[model samples]
Target: MELLDLLLHPVRLRIVNAMFGGRIRTTTDLCRRLPDVPKTTVYRHVGLLADAGILEVADERRVHGAVERHYRLSRERARIDAEAAASMTLDDHRHGFAAAMAALLAEFNGYLDREGADPTADMVSYRQFPIWLDAQEQAEAVAALTPLLRGLAEKKPRPGRRQLLLSTILFPMGEVEEGE
Candidate 1:
C-alpha cells in the first residue's frame, strides 16, 4: 500500500500514534495499549508498515521458538512527502481527514470512559480561533507555527510527561471582500 494509505488507516494510525515520541514497542505492547484493536489486525498492519519501511525492527528476542520483534517509527519514512501529498486528490484528503477525526474522537471517548477522568486537570482543550488573513499572511502564519509544532513533536517522552494530541485545521471561511 502507498505510504499515505498505510499511515492514514484507522488501526495503523493508532499504532503509529502509540509509538510516537521515539517509543520502541513490540506487537504485544501495542495490543495492550490499544485494547480495542484486535491482535490480528495490529500484527497485520505492523507487518505492512515494516515492509513499507515506515517501521523498523529495533530489536528482537527468541520467544517460544519465534522471534518477538520490537519496532519504532522510521521518522523520515513515516510521513507523506511533499510530492506524494501534492498528488493526493480532494477525495483522498477528505478521507484522510475524516479518519483522523474519528481516531481523535475515539481517543477522547476512551479517556472519558476511564475512572477518575479529569479534563481540566489533564489540560484538555478543543477551541477555535478565527483569523482573517490574506494569502501572504496565511503563509507567514503557517511558517511561524511549523517550527513550534515540529519542536514539540520531536521532544522525547519523559517522566511526568503525558501524551497529548494536537490537531490543526486552516481553510478559507468565506469569500473575502474586495478590501479587508
Candidate 2:
C-alpha cells in the first residue's frame, strides 16, 4: 500500500504515534496502550506496518516458547513526503485530516482518563495562533522549525524526562477580502 493509505488509518496512526520519540515497543506494549483496540487487531495492524516498512523489528526474544518482537518506527517510511503530498487529491487530504483528528482526540481522551490526570500540571496547551505570512516567509518559518523539531525527536529517553506529543498543522486561511 502507498504510504498515505498505510498511515492514514486511525489505528495505524495511533500505532505510529505510540512508536514515536525513539521508543521501542512490543506488540504487548502496544496492546496495553490501546486497550480499546483488540489484541488481534493491534497485532494485525502492526504486521501490516512492518510489512510496509513503516515499522521494523528492533529486537526479538523468546518468551514461553513465543517470539516477542520489539518494533520501532521507521521515520523515513512513515512520512508523507512532498511528492506524496503533492499527489494527494482533495478527498485524500480530507480523509487524512479526519483520521489525524480522530487519533488526536483518542490520545487526548486517553490522557484525560488516566489516574492523577492534570492538564494544568502537565503544562498542556492547545492554543491556535493566526499569523499573516507571505509565501517566502512561510517557507522560512517552516525551515526554521524543522531542525528544532528533529533535534527533539532525536533525543533519547532519560530520567526526569517526559514524553510529550507535539502536533503541528500549517495551512493558509486564504487572503483577506477586499472589503475587509
Candidate 3:
C-alpha cells in the first residue's frame, strides 16, 4: 500500500506515532499506550506496519513459550516520498490532512487525560501565527525550518528525556475580513 494509504487510518496513524522517538516497543507496549483501542486491533495494525516495512523487528525474546517481538519505526519507510506527495490530488490531500488532525487531537486528549497533567509545567504551546510571505519568502521559510525539524528528529530516546509530539501545518490564508 502507498504510504499515504497505509497511514491515513486513525489507528494506523496512532500506531506510527507511538513508534517514534527511537523507542523499541512490543505489541504489549502498544496496547498499554493505546488503551482505548482493542488489543486485537492494535496487533492487526502493527502487523500491517511490519509487513509494509514501516515497522521492523529490532529484537525478540521468548516469554513463557511465546516469542514477543520488539519493533522500531523505519523512519525512511514511514514517510511519503516527494514523488508520491506530488502525485496526491486535492481530495487525497484533504483526507490525509483530516486523518492527521484527528490523530493529533487524540494524542492531545490522551495527554490531558493523564494524572497530574499540567500544560504550563510541561511547556505545551498551541498557537497560530498569521504571516504574510511571498512565494520566495515561503520557500525560504520552509528551507530554514526543514533542517531544524530534522535535527530534532535525529535525537534518540534517553533517560530524563521526554518524547514530545510536534505537528505543524502551513497553508495560504484566504482573504481576510475587516477587524480591529
Candidate 4:
C-alpha cells in the first residue's frame, strides 16, 4: 500500500502521532501509552507504517531476552508530495484530514495526562485566524509550508535527544462574504 494509504488508517495515524516529535518508542512502550488500543493492533499499525517507509526501526535492544525495536517517524515534516497531493480527490483529502486530526488529538490528550494536566506548558501552542486570502491564495499556502519542512528533514538526530515536532495545518473553505 502507499504511504498515504497506510497513514489514512486511524490506528496507523495514531502510531505516527505517538512517534512524532522525535519520540522513538518500542512496541511495549506504545502499548503502555495507548492502552485503549490493543497491543496486537499497535504492532499491526507499526508494521504497516514501516512497510510504507513512513516509520523506521531506529534502534534495537534486548527486552525479554529478545530484540525490542524502537521505531521513529521517518517524516521530519509531514506533507503530501506534490504529484500525489495535486491529484487527490476531494473525498481522499477529507478522509485523510479526518484521520490526521484524530491522531493529533489523541497525542495532545496523552501529553495533558503526562504533564499533570497543566494548562500552561512550553511545548504547546494553539491559535486560529480568519484570513483575507482568496481561494487561489489559500491554495498556495502549502508551498510556503513545504520549504520549512524540507529544511527540517535534513537535520540529523542528536544523542539523548529525540527532537520531534508534530505540526498540523488546516485550511477550511467556505463561501466568502463581500466586505461591507
Q: Model 1: how far is 94 from its true place, Å?
A: 0.9
lDDT of 3 at 14: 92
TM-score of each: 0.93, 0.93, 0.94, 0.72
Worst 10 residues of 2 by lDDT: 171-180
lDDT tens per residue, model 3, 116-179: 9999999999999989887899999999999999999888888888889999899978865566
RMSD of each: 1.4, 1.5, 2.4, 3.7
Candidate 2 residue-wise lDDT at 88:
97
User: Tens-digit lDDT track for model 4 on 1-180?
Assistant: 765677687778777666766678888888987877889988887777777778888989997799989888887333467787888889989998888777777767766777476646445676766666766786698679778876775566678755554565767557666782
lDDT winner between candidates 1 and 4: 1
What is model 4's C-alpha RMSD? 3.7
Each prediction's whole-model lDDT (CA): 0.88, 0.92, 0.91, 0.73
Query: lDDT of candidate 2 vs native?
Result: 0.92
Which tens-of-lDDT digit does each residue in 110-171 have in candidate 2?
Answer: 89999999999999989999898877999999999999999988887789988788989888
Error of 3 at 130 (Å): 1.3
After superposition, candidate 3 runs with Cα above 4 Å error: 175-180
Error of 2 at 50 (Å): 0.7
TM-score of 2: 0.93
The candidates, ranked best first by lDDT, are: 2, 3, 1, 4
RMSD in Å for model 2:
1.5
